[model samples]
Target: MDHDVVLAVDIGGTKISAGLVGADGQVHRQSEVATPATRPLLEEAMRGLLTSVADGASPRAIGLASAGPVDPPRGRVSPVNITAWRDFPLLDLVGAIMPGVPSVLVGDGIAAALGEHWLGAGRGVEAMLGIVVSTGVGGGLVLNGEAYAGPSGNAGHIGHVVADPAGPLCSCGATGCVEAYASGPSMVRWAQSQGWTGPDARALSADAARGDAVALAAFDRGAQALARGIAATAALCDLDRVVIGGGVSAAGEVLFAPLRKHLDGFLTLGYVRRLTVVPFELGRSAGLLGAARSALPTAQFESPTPA
Candidate 1:
């Protein structure tokens, strides 16, 4: 079978993105569809898009990057924010659609890390963390030169880690989760609660850029929460680099400047004092590229170890 190209699909809460990705990490053709909450409809939509992209090339394998908590071992997905794909057998479904080709499932953040590791910023790093700070916070880790998907495939769920005991409630039914205070929607909510009249995060960011006191405070709050989470992750894992991506990261220095300041205050040891946080290099394509990396031969790593 030709391994020159693979079918890569990135299924997020808001959209399902499919592409024919070549070995060079370039997507030759791509399509996107809005995600629906129902299982049957969502499945049908995914099938249609895949079929269209597949055409006659018949890719060697299929790679999927999905919003979790996904059971990668079994290729099953749990409840996600946008879709009603509870306990959905994703690998089985994709296999049925593609027939005999092997398919692999991974979390979106994991996929992003893989993409960055192969074709983006995490290229030469032995240890790195890829984070998506968009509508919600998500993360994937590459430890000791390999993706570290823990038991049950839920290992890189950095967003659910509690950063504040009394912060806002997260959609995951947890209070003070990092996502509750740092996600795009959460930032908008915080700004609104501060009596700033804004439609969403974009408007709030604009207001902050204009020196609106409440908007600036809201951004600071979110950045502080993110800094706390990053520091905890660095301390726990000894990560060498942190690559931040996604929609909210578009806030640029407005968000990152404060995050760096707060991260410095949180770290105590000199060993981890040099941890670097940088913007993700691949942008939106990171997930698809990372998904494709998952389908590459495991032999790429000489040691017989699970990643």
Candidate 2:
């Protein structure tokens, strides 16, 4: 059986990833490029990636996973962290780059959830959350067997949800956002503010593993902040499971154990007791695969056509 292929692009504040994906959820060919600060340079880089992957197979559609708040209806990006893009018409740009191809745009967090649902840990689940604890905290929801993109396409900006009303100021200019305390870089910054002097999240994690008091304290604070955020989401959405991903999540049990402990105390009843937190199954590929998965019908696959 022949399946239609799609060009899948995942754009974050720091990087841009592109791939040629068959309907079966496999990324047959891919490329990564530094995300340009400016829109034109970013678009050029994406065009180059698409052209490179188009060498062997013609794609019927384009699937994009971008940082929010993206105008899914218009396919434009309004990312808070990436300053150059303010309501940038991303969907139109990609459509123009590959004329006649149908395009679908989704938030990276939501895309991650869809990706996990199709090929990762969330498979067969009717309700779940995909959380990315990287440079910032972002999340997406799969509720009732569909990806939930709230009105305005900003449904999963869970990072902005206030976990500590008096916590550090966030890039969003808000106080107490989960990202302000729990993001990888934010954890490092918090540690520095505490006079720990760790250079990065990796070093901090290492020091914590060695039982460094300051490092452990910093990680504990981060874990608590993340737990607060997750608990809030679980309370509101009644999530059955959560899949945590991104660089910070690499801390493994160092992070999860504390998160679980904190969440347990925060929960009040049946919903709280049933929520399960797990590691993300696809690692870095979740965003790209999720973007590709968004292009297909949910929960099923079609074979790809021969090149």
Encode model 2's per-residue lDDT on 180-272: one tens digit a residue. Answer: 989888899989988998799999988988888888887889989988888888888888889989888898878888888888888777756
Which stretch of 10 consecutive residues in model 1 shows the poorest summed lDDT? Answer: 298-307
TM-score of each: 0.92, 0.92
Q: Write one digit per residue (lDDT tens) for candidate 1, span 257-276.
A: 88898998998878788899
What CA RMSD would candidate 2 show?
Answer: 2.9
Error of 2 at 17 (Å): 0.9
Error of 2 at 140 (Å): 0.5
Off by over 4 Å in 1: 1-3, 298-307
lDDT of 1: 0.84
TM-score of 1: 0.92
Q: Model 2, residue 282: displacement in angstroms?
A: 0.9
Clashing pairs in 1: 115-290
lDDT of 2: 0.83
